[model samples]
Target: MKIEGIVLIGIGAFMAVVSVGYWFWSGEPSGTAMLIGAVLLGLLPGGYYYWWAKRMKPRPEDRPDATTREGAGVIGSFPHGSIWPLVFGAGAFLFGLALAFGWWFLPPALGLMLVAATGVTTQSRRGGAI
Candidate 1:
């Protein structure tokens, strides 16, 4: 999370700096306005990182053995052993590619994939072998 915050701040600061440079080079009101907007937005992530890093602390009750400790509900709930995720991801990619490339066969292919995925998911839910 801290790394994410830093990355956000870095991206925002980069946009602000680039906008400022563009404003000076192009002498455009839009660029100057964008610079101000980017800077304001950039401050948000930076401030969030500072506040979170300083304010957050691990309490005694937050230990791993605590019943309410992080991710307690996740234990033994489900094993990370599903192949459906890969199938769904492939279907999504195909769908997106079809949408982008305007292929004639894409729509029907995507629909078939969706139906197959639904069937597989139902079977899994019924405790049948995938």
Candidate 2:
């Protein structure tokens, strides 16, 4: 994570320099603005990851002396065979189809999405064996 964050920050820094040069050379705002946006895309999450990395204990992978066995174990329980995800996909499909079929599909789509979201949340809160 720390290395990842550093790489992203490096990318953002490189882009920033490029953007400045591009702005001066082309004298165009749009391309410079997009380049600036790219800078933010790299920086924002990079900063977040770096910040969290600083606070977290280094993982087995992060440690030089750690063995493969040190990392081999159950990390945490994750949801399996979940139905809410399928329902959410169905709702999302309906929403997309509404663009061509009619505006009438919008309400039902939204409703289905909301219901699925709520169900997933409920299931997650219940913990283990979804």
Could you tell me which residue pairs clash in candidate 2? none
| CA deviation > 4 Å runs, candidate 1 | 1-11, 27-45, 58-79, 96-104, 108-130
Report the alpha-carbon TM-score of model 1 versus the true structure: 0.41
Tens-place lDDT per residue, model 2, 1-130, is: 7998998998899999999999999999999999999999889999998999999988898889999899988876786678999999999999999999899999989999999999988898888544
Candidate 2, residue 64: Cα displacement in angstroms equals: 3.0
For model 1, which pairs clash? none
- Estimate, for each residue in 64-94, the C-alpha lDDT of model 1 and write its tens digit: 4645445344333353466666676677778
TM-score of each: 0.41, 0.84
- Stretches off by above 4 angstroms in model 2 are 72-74, 128-130
